[model samples]
Target: MTAPGLFVSFEGIDGSGKSTQARLLAETLRARDRDVVLTREPGGSPGAEEIRALVLQGDPDRWSAQTELLLFTAARRDHLERTIRPALAAGRIVICDRFADSTRMYQGLSRGDLRPAVDQLHDLMIGTEPDLTFLIDMDPGQGLARAKSRATAEERFEDFGLDLQTRMRAGFLALAREFPDRIRVIDGNRAKAAVAADVLAVLEAELS
Candidate 1:
């Protein structure tokens, strides 16, 4: 039987390599004969997936900051009930691509409080934080350029504009500051293999 497991998250601005490292880590763990659940926020489950599409489908001209926050929170609640809580209870290591911190960075900081109603929306969702978070950090321009290089098309978050993304990157680092022990900052500009190795080292440490 699987023993009690750990909850870990990878987060960052777009193209900071959160998803790639998360998947790589999961695969590595599986290779080592450990049960690893790889998942993402705002779409880990059916209800959440719908919300995710709303959040990332288009540009800022279509979705407002507050709207994006609500969708994220909505999907998060679904993720909490459908994926995270269940996997943890079943004793499976859970590595999420993004979590509450993403919201705090994308919505909390970039949006500038979002005209007050956003606070209420956040309260309605954005539940407990992760047990451990790997903040894959890099320069905003570098991150965005990486994203563009890898992507065939842009998403809503991608079209958030440069200044907004810079603020979001700062926001992520600031959030990482609040939970120093829980959040580990990784140099995302490193080679993917090097970054994956760093993630593996951190996970091994966390697990041990």
Candidate 2:
């Protein structure tokens, strides 16, 4: 009988190494002869990718926090229908670079006032959450520096500055408290290999 699919998500402040860790985990799982799908939001699917450009590009103020939340929710819905759900049904281990938690932190703390709305929208639309979430915890200063080191057009969220990133880190931590059973906080300030190993250990415990 085919085993049930496992859904894992990597989340943290921008530049917290979640992306790298997500990729590394996927590689490790595949090396173990597991059928794995490494995907990311808000561009996991074709329709979501189209929305990704709109939300990640242009001026930082291109959309209000509420509007941005809606866009993300729309992209997430599409990603689920077209990419995530299908892969999970096929019994593939789905590793997502950033899932709904990102929206909660980015929009929730960035605007403070919009957090309730973000939660409401999420509950109403994108209800599926990852089975395991790795919150790559790190200092906002270091994280922002790392994020800025990368030259990418998707600077809309990265452009929020250090102050916001600081709050985002705190927000993510608080969020971790809310989902202790599913969200594991990993120290991301360590070397890449070290963080990857820690992530792998967590996966080994949960997935094995």
TM match of model 2 to true structure: 0.96
> Candidate 2 — which residues are off by over 4 angstroms?
1-3
Please list all clashing residue pairs in model 2, or write none if there are none.
none
Where does candidate 1 have its weakest 10-residue lDDT segment?
A: 114-123
Q: What is the C-alpha lDDT profile of model 2 across 104-193, one tens digit per residue?
A: 888766765777888888888877889999999999999999998998998888887998899889999999999999999999999999
lDDT of 2 at 91: 87
Best by TM-score: 2
Q: How would you encode candidate 1's per-residue C-alpha lDDT over 1-208 as one tens digit per residue?
A: 1236678899999988899999999999999998888999868999998877777776576766676777777788888899888898888889899987777777777776753454466556654667889999988898887777776444567777677779888878887787798999999988999999999998788778
- Report each candidate's C-alpha RMSD, comma-separated, in the order given: 2.7, 1.8
